[model samples]
Target: MKYFLLTTLVSLAFLTSCRTLQNTQKPSAGAAHQSQEQQYKAAVVSKAQTAQCVTAKINMDVDADGKQISCGGSLKMKRDDVIQLSLTFLGFEVGRLEFTPKDVLVVDRIHRQYSRASYAEVDFLHQAGLDFYALQSLFWNEIFTPGSRDVRSQLNRFRLAASGDYTSLLLTDAPKLNYQFLTRTSSALLDRVTVDGKTAADQGQFVWKYDNFTTLGGKLFPTSMAVSISGMGKKAGFTLALSRLNNDTDWPTRTTISSKYTQIKATSLLDKLAGMAQ
Candidate 1:
């Protein structure tokens, strides 16, 4: 169960190592080529322009290397501010994961241990371009370009295409990564995002899928998500089913750690995950 909590946090950042689009009639055959592209860019970007905060009770289920565990928790986030998840078992709090602009924090209450590190200090996250805003966008169900807080300004870099029943937004500008976002044409909702390594040395892909949409803060938001990563010689993922979601902004954004808890190196957290999977 401890490992499950830790893995859940890593997957949210590393696994996202991880989309938006909308519906519009196919442009006329003679229409300007970018006409359809422009419409999608507008529709997708508009979905995220208004949301700034979110809070929810989450039922988290994790499956990594064929081991599974279920836990309950709450998730809280404020755009560009913080993202936090609390884990509990048998009505007792056990662990917590928090991400802020400056660093990532993980606490294991049962073990009296914790770790904190800046984004640049985490090798896997840095190599995959999974920063605070990028991970936030993934949770908020928005398309994003690596290192940019807003994807609107970079729409020109994405190639939009409608195929069969889905609209795809593809970005190939990352040094060794390719990002693809897909929306179902029928529902016109951003449903999935995939990141694939471009070189043999960095082989593997991350797939994040959003589902179970409901209205939150007057906007359609996904209340469930499934994140899976494969290749790189290992497979892991987690699913979150959220309930009682609200756009509440009343909670504190930062957590205080006790001096008595042992501080471990951030890299050790990754090693613990690797050990758990084996």
Candidate 2:
């Protein structure tokens, strides 16, 4: 009777081991799907980044009452290089905006005005109510090698949640931004960014819309942008439009004007303006 009991126990153990091995050999379908999705996203980003150069036209409209503005312009972005944007409003020259990893320049040939700033100057620009960090982050991979501490963290913070039919992502910080990126089948792209933070009563909460993305050199870029603030009527919104994109050559930077002094002056000016407006 003892032998019989021992044989029965051995049989049960063998069956249990076989079951474990079978389970280990098979991966869950959900895990496999997720792996495939990750691969696809990596491929999409790679392809989007490799398109040699991108050039497109853009336009911009601002509506405080509507809480948004639309704008479009022409943009040319070279792979792992710089982006040059030529802006025009109503057939009149607005200016040209250029961005590199270390610098940003806005040259207004019509007004013979130029403004230059460095990455560190971003904080100053933000304080001056002229933040362009979004533009910098958008073409970050092209401007830089993409592994620096600043760029790496930024990249990881904003990821491609979905692409193809329509693109969407979740931004890490400032949830009040309520940022959303979407691209249509026709290659048009739209970005809705909200600014929710403590501000003086005059500024209040703001929601900005950057829309009407067009393709240039096979890459998509925003052409129109609008900014609207709470309590301000729609007519008070700001709008900008782009007329041309020059990717055929490089922009001369030897004569670029630094904004170091302007930034300091802007601080005092902003304080005065804030006081007066209040």
Candidate 3:
């Protein structure tokens, strides 16, 4: 169960949290006349103007196999470059999870060890077709296709379905994964994203739900997010309650891992995190 935490962190990036929007209006008659594809395209355009950089202080909770750990954390993201999540306890840093264009790095501060691996070295991530940009969309409150940096060219491949008050866009071309995004039918704000595995080896589900939206950079950004994962006869997930969000981009994108820290295999990262949390 502890090992799956690495998968959970890599797969569940940013999520929605904060104040809910109560007054978003329905589409106009002109918008109603547009095809589902066209309407979705417009929503994509509207959400594309995301923040170039974001920094937030986070209260995070991790639950796995009936064990729960809570910590103070921080989130920092620079668009197209890096996303970093740092965990602390008693005001001292305990662990760090970082994603860059080239690799994923997990630092176990308490153990003075770290693990670094290419994205391809992560099995579930490689199978799900997620990359840096796709994970960036989750953190930045935007929608995305798996392999493409931009979703515009891939619009036609998504199938839309309306159910009750929300619309779902399903990716039909994903062979190893089933990915879906749900948005409010009235305002087109993204509400949830679900990804499920299609095969036995990849038999798990990842759910990222958004709510309590507040305006950031003139956009409706989710300040709180809940992520849940269940698979392989075990369950593990985390929630990030974010505060003090800002567009601060002054920090360096890359962190230099010190030679004093001994490098460890990526597979042992979550084990170290779980032990540290206890």
Candidate 4:
């Protein structure tokens, strides 16, 4: 059941970078002045392109099945390299998750245990073709293709068009996963992203919604995000409201598990996370 903490932290990080949507109700972007591709590029993390790091203090609430947990945490991220997030419950540390290009390091402060896994070692992540860098892109407010880091080259795969109150970016017949991103037609700000696919352990449909925009360091940034992840047997997800963000400066680059903590196998960890441990 404690694996719940790990998954929650992991999912929360994926939901943050995409939250920079500025909530404006301008006049429907004037009938798509540019091509869909142009609109996508324009809508992505604009002023954030020059950023090498980011940090934010946020409040989170997560629900898995009928179980729910609420906590406050901080997100400290270094572009393309690592993300360090620490969760606290009433001023006490409860969990920590760090994502690097090579592995995910999780620390269960409540239980005093820790685990580490490469993308290939985590069955769900492996089957979904999700990696640390790809996750980082999503956190950085840029769209991503699992296993691909260059969003610039991958833009051609998406077909863009206006759909009612929103402009949509669609990837059909994808080799691994189908993806969709919706933006408000009025402001062209990203509203959400959808990921549909099956992992080794289950089929998954994930949606991330962005809102409550604010200006941080002179650039528009998202202050709130909601994540919904539903799989075959269960549903788990969370919502975040960021109270602070530092768009400049790097954070801790490595997650070092102490020798005092018990080391466990990656598969065993996943079983516990899925509540399949016997």
Which candidate number maximizes TM-score? Answer: 1
Taking all chains together, each candidate's TM-score versus the true structure is 0.90, 0.48, 0.82, 0.82
Instruction: For model 1, give the 10-residue run with minimal summed lDDT.
Output: 18-27
Model 2, residue 85: displacement in angstroms? Answer: 3.9
Local accuracy of candidate 2 as per-residue lDDT tens digits, 1-278: 12221221222111111100001122225867657545543433443433455454655443323334333445566544466665555575455557665665655444354555664554433432332334433432211111332333344343344445754433324312223333332332335443333223333344445555555456554555554444332123455454464345443433354343232232332243233223
By lDDT, the better pick of 1 and 4 is: 1
* Residue 184 error, candidate 1, Å: 2.2
Better of 1 and 4 by TM-score: 1
Could you tell me the TM-score of candidate 2?
0.48
- Please write out the lDDT profile of model 4 over residues 56-90, one tens digit for every residue: 89898887665688889888888888888778888
* Error of model 4, residue 32, in angstroms: 12
**Per-model CA lDDT versus the true structure:** 0.79, 0.40, 0.70, 0.68
Q: Considering lDDT, where higher is better, how would the candidates rank from best to worst?
A: 1, 3, 4, 2
Where model 3 places Cα greater than 4 Å from the true spot, the runs are: 1-36, 199-203, 267-278
For model 2, the superposed segments whose C-alpha errors exceed 4 Å read: 1-30, 47-49, 62-81, 87-96, 106-114, 122-134, 137-167, 173-247, 250-278
Candidate 4: residue 120 Cα off by (Å): 0.9
Model 2, residue 101: C-alpha shift (Å): 2.9
Q: Please, what's the RMSD in Å of model 1?
A: 3.7
**lDDT string, candidate 1, 134-182, tens digits:** 8888888999988998688888777776789998887776776778888
Clash total of candidate 2: 24
